[model samples]
Target: MIGARLREWARRHSDKGRYTPVGIIFHWVMAALVILQLALGWYTTRMYAGGDRLTAYQWHSDLGLLILFLAFLRFAWRMMVPGPINDADKGGWQTNIAYATHVVFYLCFFGLPITGWMMWSALGDGRPLYVAGLVPWPQMPFGGLDPQWQWAILDWAEDLHQMFILILIILIPLHVGAALKHHWWDRDDVLEGMLPDVKDADDHREGLTHKPKRPRSPRVTGAG
Candidate 1:
C-alpha cells in the first residue's frame, strides 16, 4: 500500500512543468559523461607513443559503452515521464527547430557508441574489451568478417563516428545558447524547467505573492 502511494506521488511530481528529480539527475550526469568522453577521445587521438595511449583508448571504449547503456535508460524514463512542455506562445519555427535538435541529440546518443563498437569489431585484433579493466565485453559480430571487408567497414564506421562527434560539438553549444537565450532574453521558464531547485514561472510568481512584505514607512505631514 505504501509502495503504491509512493509511486503515485512520484508520478504526480514528474508530470509538473519542471523536470522530475530523476530527469534532472540523468540530464546533468549524461552531460558530464559526454564532455568527459569528448576529452578522452581527443586526447587519445593526439597521443600515440606508449602503454598510456592504449589505456586511453580502453577508457574511451568503456565510457562509450556506459553512455550507450545510460542513454537507453534515459530514453525509457523519457517515455514513461513526459518532459516539461514548451512555451505555447513561442513561434512555430522555433518550436519545430527545438524538437528537431532534440531528435538529432537522441540519434547521436545512440549512434556514436554503436559506430564505435562496430569499428572496434572490424579491427579484429583478438584483444578483449574490458570495462574499466574489469569485465570483458563481447565484440560485435563484424569481427568474424573477411579482412578486406572488415577494414573497409571499419573505415566507414570511423568516419561516421567522427561525423556524429562533430555534430554533437556543434549542437551542444546551440542547445545551451537557446536555453540561455530563453532564460535571460525571453525571461521564460525554459531553462529552469530542466533545473531541479529553481521554480517554474508560475511557482515563482506564487512565491512572490505569498512572501511577507516589509511594513511601509510613515509619511511626514508636519510641513502641511
Candidate 2:
C-alpha cells in the first residue's frame, strides 16, 4: 500500500516533466560532491609525500566512501521511481547513447570507490578508514595474504581506480554538454526537470499573463 502511494506521488511529478524534490536533491548534491572529489583527487596526487599528503588521501577516501553510499541510495531510489519522459526521451540514437552514458556513470560511481577501498585495504598499514569521517568502514580482507600477494592486490586496485577516474574525467564534460543541448537547442524541460522549483521574476510575469488584469480606476478631472 505504501509503495503504491509513493509511486503515485513520484508519477505525478514525472508527468509534469519534473523529478520529485527528493530526486532533484540527490542529483545535485551528488553532482557537487563528485566534482569536488575529482578535483581533490587530482590535487592530492600532486602533493609531496608527507603528513599533509596522508591527510589529503584520507579526505579523498572519506569523500569516496560517502559518494559510494549515496550512489547506492540513489540507485535504489531510481529503481523505485522512474525518471520523467521529457523531450530528450524521444526515440533516437541520441537517446540510446544517453542511456548508455548513464550506465557508464553508475559503473564509475561504484567502481571507483570499491577499487579505492581495496587499495587502502591492501596497503596493510593498519591505518583506519572512515566514511565521511563518521561511520567506520571496513577494508577488504587482504591482511591474510602474503606480502607479495598484498602488493599485487594494491597494484591491481590502483590500476582499476585510475581507469575509473579517467573515464569520469572524460564523461563529465560530455554529460554537461548534452544537458545544455537539451535545455538550449532542444528548448525542452529535460534539464529543468532536475532543477529546483524556483519562482523567478520571469515565471511570475508568465503566471500573470494568464490572469485577468484589474480595471483602471476612473480618473477625476476636477483638479484640471
Candidate 3:
C-alpha cells in the first residue's frame, strides 16, 4: 500500500527535470580546476619558505588570485542554479555525503582566496597580481596596523587554506567513485544528467512508438 503511493508520487513529478545537467558545464569543469589549484597551492607554499626564492612565491600569488576569482564564479553558479538530485535517485548516504562534501569544498575554495586577498592587500611583494596583463584587480585594504600580527594572521589563514584543499582532494575520489558506481553497478543514468550531450529520457520517449516496459530498465534498481 505504501509502496504504491510512493510510485504514484514519483510518476507525477518525474516529468519535470531538475536544475542539474543543464546547458552549463561548469559543474564538472570547475571541479577539475579546483583540483589543479590545490596542487599549485601546495607547491607555492613550499617555495614561500625560501625553497626556490625567485619562482617560489610568484606562482603562489597568482594561483591565490585565480582561486579567488574561480570561487566567486563557482559560488555564484551554485546559487544561480542548484544542481539536480542524484542521477541514480538514491538519496541516502550517497546524497548526504555528496551535499556535505560540496559545502566543505566551497568553504575551502572560497576561504583561501579571501584570505589570500587580505594577504596580498597588506604585504604585497612590491607588485600586483594580474591576468593576461589585461586587468588589475584591487586587493582588500586593511587600514594601518601592526605589521607583525597581520603577518601572523595571514600565515595561519594560508595554512588552513592548504589544509582544506588537502581534505577536499581526498574526498573528491570518493564522490566521483559513487557517481560512476551508479552507472556501472546500478545501471542508472543519474550520472548522465551532467554529462555532455546526453539524450534526455523525454526525448528518447518521444521517438518510441511502443508502450514502456514493466520495469523502468532491465531490472528494479535504486533504493528510493
When 1 and 2 are scored with lDDT, the better candidate is 2
User: Taking the tens digit of each residue's C-alpha lDDT, what string does model 3 give over 147-169?
Assistant: 78668767876677667667877
RMSD of 2: 8.8
List clash counts for every candidate, in order: 0, 0, 2
TM-scores for candidates 1 onward, in order: 0.81, 0.88, 0.68
lDDT order, best first, reads 2, 1, 3
Against the unseen true structure, what C-alpha lDDT does each candidate score? 0.79, 0.88, 0.61
TM-score of 2: 0.88
Candidate 1 Cα deviation (angstroms), residue 185: 0.8
Residue pairs of candidate 2 with colliding backbone atoms: none
- For candidate 3, give the lDDT of residue 7: 45
- Largest lDDT belongs to which candidate? 2
Error of 2 at 40 (Å): 0.7
Tens-digit per-residue lDDT, 153-187, candidate 1: 99999999999999999999989999888776666
- lDDT (C-alpha) at residue 151 in model 1: 86
Q: What is the C-alpha local distance difference test score of candidate 3? A: 0.61
- The pairs that clash in candidate 1 are none
